[model samples]
Target: MTGPSIVVAGGGSAGHIEPALAFADAVRRLRPDARVTALGTERGLDTTLIPARGYPLELIPPVPLPRKPSGDLLRLPGRVRGAVARVREVLSGVDADAVVGFGGYVALPAYLGARGRVPVVVHEANARAGLANKVGARFAEAVAVAVAGSGLPGEQVVGMPLRRSITGLDRVALRAEARAFFRLPPRGPVLLVFGGSQGARTLNTAVAEALPGLVRAGVAVLHAHGRGGQAAPPAPGYVPLPYIERMDLAYAAADAVLGRCGMTTVAEVTAVGLPAVYVPLPHGNGEQALNAAPVVAAGGGVLVEDAELTGERALAELLPLLTDPRRLAAMGAAARASGHADADERLARLVLDIVYRHNLESARGAVGSDDRATEVLRPDPRVWRQQ
Candidate 1:
């Protein structure tokens, strides 16, 4: 009488939540009858994002895996045991037919709870697999990755699951409207800047330092300085926001991007075909730089280390590219070429395949016609260029 019950577990940061949301979006689009509930924790950004997107969010206590051994580490076993029990409750309540994870704090419990209970599908967005995903992949029915070599079993290279807005963007067609939305000139080059969801002080400082030079060159700037993190001085053709809700429009308005190399950011920027200057965070296990490597290798972007991305350095590097139309267009094309716009559909189909036992022919009939089948997973090759 009802479609399969699906639970997606990816909580904590935007990097984890956004991809999970995108995959949930795809699942709904492909199978409207299915019930998709996002498994999250109260402490995560999911509390805001999941509800806003109209998905049911089930919250649980966060079980943080402490890196260094300490009191928290001592309590790890009991904490994990309690968290896994809570996850089992959530999964049972939802009658989850399958567990799809994007790898975050909640994923560990989800993986443990769903063990031998329901089919598990793990999608890792980073070049390097995380501890949670590394565990989940042990028994995951299907393991997918944006970039290969994540060391997850049966890891197939299926790009990041991006929202339809980005996957379906027509930047050139909406450039004027997008620029107008930000109260900027419709014809000049615009550069979009942002760090991760929380904003980056390093980027804010660098972009602030480069603002005067950018303004003088008639370059418009739209900076999402992250919530509660802004120090950029006011200048002509410059706009700063606490956060960016309409990244689709932001991509349309910008000729190029200057931002962090988080997997979600890289996926969205490239999915929309925007040339970028990716500054990988200097911390962590060096996965951020790995996220940006392929694009840089394909000549679609420039990768800079966080320590080296000064305002003076930003101005010197970005100035020439913003001014050069042909080169920028070329870079955008290359970025698009390396990106997988159909990842959402492909992942959705994969989910259907395992959960519902959907075969190729039945899947096509359920998703599209014979004609549409040939091209359902192929992104339109048209590159969006700045007006």
Candidate 2:
């Protein structure tokens, strides 16, 4: 028999969608014939991401909800009904033996609409459990988490799945390739700055304020100011891109990273073995800082609180490392050591195990209804072995 088909439903941003793609790729690696579909709203990054990855894409209607019992609460029931309908419609054509939700607004309806006989798994990518993942977790056969602190049931610490391009980068080749890609100086330290996708205004402001001194110290900088951030005019030693297209090259080129502590960013940095100065988003319950704590605790990076990330303090934290080559190398090695390279493979197997088990249970249930209660269907051993 052919390998079971699976659906990955999540998006809205690259952080959630990219990891889903990584898991899908991992599944393809193990079961070449397995069919994988990505279901997300057409409005999200999925429109570009799914097609670019050459996966079947399905779009569903958006469900708007309230944060604090606003007037939108009155329309809650109708919105949910519409969302469920949209999810069912999107899922109807595909024979998904399993469904995996990487937490986002899109995940909630995907899980609710697909949950029953088909096994479902939810992967929460934040330190704090997101609402979509939290709701999906209750019905999920298993839950995967990027951070250990995510408070969700059936939680397994899988780390974040990184793309093969980034994960497979060879260190020696990366060093040379990265330098060529960024056009950096032969042997000077390079600082990479980013703030997830939307760009942290606070982080950008601080980096811009501190740039002159960093330049004076002979440190090269490759900055991703974000799509909507302060546009500082170009300087001799600094290169600012609104967005970075080639992350592997950027990671390879950096001696150190200074950025927000989104779970995805932290995982990518750890995977690449690049040390960072993390400035976690101050609002939203400090989840970003919580995500970065493990790396900081492991001595792989430094965490700078948003309130404390002034120009002088940022300089103070970054300057010593730029000047000390040995310390930077040690930090980079430590960061890489903290990453889990096998995360995508293990997560893919776990998802399949749940699906196979659910299928067997369903088969047995059908047998009982047909007055063959004593008979039970056993899945082929190959499924278990593959899982």
Candidate 3:
């Protein structure tokens, strides 16, 4: 099959953008001649990250649907119509064969614009479906999810698409180099702590207060405090940085992880076979806790409430795990078993399958077989919606 021109859409945070980029990379790998265009909002991190990764990103105005009565709510219809119109223009200009949506403000427009004209594939990274994905799924030919029971129509558990750097990481081989890079001790179990890209104050404070106990237990600390946050005054065995550019290296150097259970973070840590203690964010729709449930159930990690994650609580729980090599190894093995390293390839295959099916239907339609073409071209009722 000739490479199909595809539009991949999503952005805002690394969670959505990362998966979209990973999937795009996979498509290119499968079809070197593939022309992949990314659609994202200008307000998102994609303005920088997408171009840096060498993919062309077309900017769209964000169509944020206000949930409550307000001025933005009143303007919602106009905003959505404008965004969708702009997206449709881009799709036609690019001659897109299909669209893959990874659920964000940008995804709704992309999905709406491409619904009837192209094969639409929606990927939901969270265990719980987001609002954008919920609407996208209504018209999507295929719906992929990171976890089971996402409540989206036609949902298939294709796992999360991880970057090549992370999927190809060799933690065992790079252990020494990683330790040296992070200025960690040559010998001693390392505990890696991070929240998201913005850093969680709860995590930082808890870990800081617990550092003395962790250090006394011969556990080295490598903390990524996010932007503007610093490590609690420098102490022996504690290394803190505002952000970690190379997370693969940090994973390689760590014996266990302490952080929030965002889908990307949990997926990456488990993919690399790292035991973790996940603290789901206290706010939002409670999806973070849901994201961590499977990992904790699989014995790959532990889940702690945000309120319970104090320095004292951390020491009480993590000290024993860090000290016991056998237990740590067992947890790592469980994590590796539970993680899906081939998720990128799996999702790519799904997208290609949809494209191929659409092509076959288009060819049949061109042959003038009205009944056959209609049957082939009709949208599946399970996914199709009037709006």
Candidate 4:
């Protein structure tokens, strides 16, 4: 295990990449000499993200597959084969001991790319399993999950890993610093809105339409409209930016939050103890909603059906909550209770254990027995690929 090299793979969005990077940092902490490299498709945010994090990144080709059976199904086998070949080629060049997938189309190739004896570990960040993670799970020595009930094999609830910067901040100090950083009135209640890494158009539109009403009611706003969301500034109390460079500031100053229910979003809000109004993406299965359910059930935040969230409707719900300071305080406390602060370390330990065990087993005569041996938790497969 000396100077062990690990490949952290999966990226298309910041959600997947951030967790991978966090785990890499944890690996460095555990073994300062450990070499970590990131593998992702050229198309994902990894191009800028991986490099910015100061990791060596290898570009792979795209692996696009429909969630459902489609004409794309015909290309799956060939695409997976090609991706596997490319992954193998990458592994050949690196001194890798294990490959870790963070759940995405890119993870499929990452797991498939491994040659004999190298263990593969995966992290699934939702209650419902993702397709790439599902396939990769079959090859995994262990699969770490953010939620308890995922259908993947060998799954353990590790909580969603967050960056050290986020994990280390003190909430009270952060809030004061955040308000100052955003130039908001120190005494006013702040409402934060975002639509994940790539803004949600529907969410953006509704929030924009509701902005004036929010401002009139005396609420201060720090909104991350995303590149896809509205770019125009709404009014005086509201600040609309293409993106928020310092998420710590955005999270710190917020009394209430409005955003999508992606796993990373849910984790960060919970970690920061920010009350939220989660609008799940409507199209794919109910994965986003599922991701937010435990928090809503715990009274940490309210869940709004995307289709039913009209501008008037959102205003009616949000205004009352924002106007009530006591209620916001209660919700904020509940949100903080949902965070597992040591998630990154827990997941990193799980991965390292799996890698060590798999390697040890291979050194013994236990070869093929470890390949398909996974801790299977029965999840409804019908729901795994939906969202």
Candidate 5:
């Protein structure tokens, strides 16, 4: 209670965990003394990721929302109570000054627990808001989004919070080295392909079928086919990776990218100023398409439906763009123009501001006076770059 203790709540998929970790990273930088604990559930990847990031992990019961009317819906009330109560215990144990949440199942409980006790800050990383985020926004003291039109409560679009490796990547200077790391030639346009830990079947199949032709067209490739994906003999000018630990190097080696249009992907691609061909997941609420809308509108990237991303289509749509220097440069510039490379720091400042302000008011016996006039401070830019 004496020092600011921040809790970042986002669990399950990499989409949720990555941003939470990114925010935690920035918090550690800006508030070195602040204790940052990751709020997660035993059901999610946080069991491994949180501790791996050097943050204490606290598990809570998950209350996943049913998509339709069902028996699960009937149990919603009881589940919410259990989850919120556990979150309350976690908050109290950590002396939480604020709950900074990237919306997911865990975020809802974190929001409910922090309602009157500590200020809640919600961050929506997609163009369309999810159920937990929508609910969290109603009570959040501050709201941040990756892009406009999130349909969440806030107009503060700070873009996605990303690690400094991406924000500070000097692609031009690292190109030769990145190429060398991938065992690629220093010249020719490179297409860096990745589709997450579980390979996107569409990307894997299409790229494989198009590989020989892509090489014939004078394009080199560094493709991560996900762990346990299919394998084959290494072709000339093509490098296949089972996993990519150094994305900074990958981005440096890429002239253009081929991947799905998720918020994290879009943010990282744009933050590093690379042209991408986004293939949105055909299912879900179509938020994937919306996530890529701004970049497509800016002529920074191309959006293709997953069902339509065949080998021929990829060649027709991607070949010219990847090969053309002028077009690639312009698209990269446009992508960078739409990026918020400093979002991690910006949101960290916002979180610390809300926490410190609330603490000051409590000290002055002015708790809950609705005074959020805290000025956001920026850390020296050199600090992040040096890191």
Candidate 6:
């Protein structure tokens, strides 16, 4: 018998793509015979990263909804129609049993195309719901979120779907290897800092200015400044790189983190039990601050306004935390308590449950069953109950 086919959709930044990939990996692990296809746009990072990770990627035209009245807004209907048509073709070709979306331009079409035809599952990765996900949630059979109260219908907080490297990481056992990989001294406490994939000018500048103070306080630094960003000048206790390919190593090497509060960053740091100092982006929809709120409330991290995160301010706040082992250890434990390392598994199980229910519905329809018990769908109660 041909195994069930699943379509996983999302891609733009690493935030969306990584989770989609993690969920796909989980599905493959759980059901080796399952066929998984990734739906993404050519315009985003998915074009390169998806194929590189060994998944067959189906491309769809991007239908970006314009916030303001413009030419793009006028043409939006035609673009959406085309994208949805393309998604339908892909879904039919794969005989998709379920469509799982991680919320991106590509996901909106997948959700629309699969609605009423197959089971649809949506995963919202931010505290603030994006337009794509907001719409998808309305039609989705199962809606999952990384943060609570995300303004979506039937939202279940399943945490972020994390990469296997992160979920399976043994930070304590790999500490020596990670430190050696970065060429840092094995003895001192190392602080890891980075913005998102595109890098943050504010963080880069503040850390550059604060390096002397950190070095003096016996703290070593591993800085991934993002692609094309200027590296800090060499110092005895500082290591600077434009990008970090092996983030698991970086996390393993660090005692604490100083970074933005993007959903993926917050999830990864807390999963590994690393204390953090989060500086939410000053601009945008203010979701970053909301993303870091639960962790901060849990005493896993501290949140500072972007404006207040100066070199001196960072040193003043971080120095005390770095010097105090007991406080750092307490914060680490709190972080781990707040994080869900099994998020990928939970999401994968949700997908499978949707597929199972879809198959059952199909079977019921074929038999013309009138029994309410046969019609009533119950997913794995344990999986659905994950908060």
Q: TM-score, each model? A: 0.88, 0.91, 0.93, 0.86, 0.91, 0.94
Question: Ten-residue segment with the worst summed lDDT in candidate 6?
Answer: 378-387
Clashes of 2: 0
The TM-score that candidate 1 achieves is: 0.88
Q: By summed lDDT, which 10 consecutive residues of candidate 1 come out lowest?
A: 378-387
For residues 1-387, write the lDDT of model 2, one tens digit per residue. Answer: 457689898778888798999999988887777789988886768899888998998877666545677878787667667877877766667778888999777787788888774778999888898778888899888989887978899689988888888778775677877877778775688999998666788788888888888989998888888888875556766878888889888988888999988888999899988899999888887799999988998889999888898878889999999889999989989998887766788789887777666655676687754223223433353544374
Among these predictions, the greatest TM-score belongs to 6
Candidate 4: stretches off by over 4 Å: 68-72, 231-234, 359-387
RMSD, each candidate, Å?
7.0, 3.1, 5.1, 7.5, 4.2, 3.2
Model 3 Cα lDDT, one tens digit per residue, 150-262:
89998998889999889888988999999999999988899999997778898999988999888888999999998966577788889998899999999999999999999
lDDT of 3 at 56: 95
Candidate 5 residue spans exceeding 4 A from truth:
228-234, 366-387
Q: Which stretches of candidate 2 lie over 4 Å from their true place?
A: 89-92, 231-236, 361-380, 383-387
RMSD from true fold, candidate 6: 3.2
Per-residue lDDT over 1-387 for candidate 1, one digit per residue giving the tens place of the 0 to 100 score: 356678999899878898888888888877767799998998869899999999999887788977688999899788889888988998899888889999878898888989988889999999999889999999999999998788788899999998888999999999989999989788889999998667999999998899999999999899999886975989898999989888899999999999998888888889999999999988999999999999999999999899999989999889999999999999999999989998987887787667654223444787777556434423221110000
Residue 106 in model 4: lDDT: 83
Better of 2 and 6 by TM-score: 6
RMSD in angstroms between candidate 4 and the native structure over all alpha carbons: 7.5
True lDDT of residue 48, candidate 3: 88
Clashing pairs in 6: none
Q: Report the lDDT tens digits of candidate 4 across residue range 228-304.
A: 66743557767777788898878778889888998888988898787899999998778899888888988899999
Stronger candidate by TM-score (1 vs 4):
1
| Highest lDDT scorer | 6
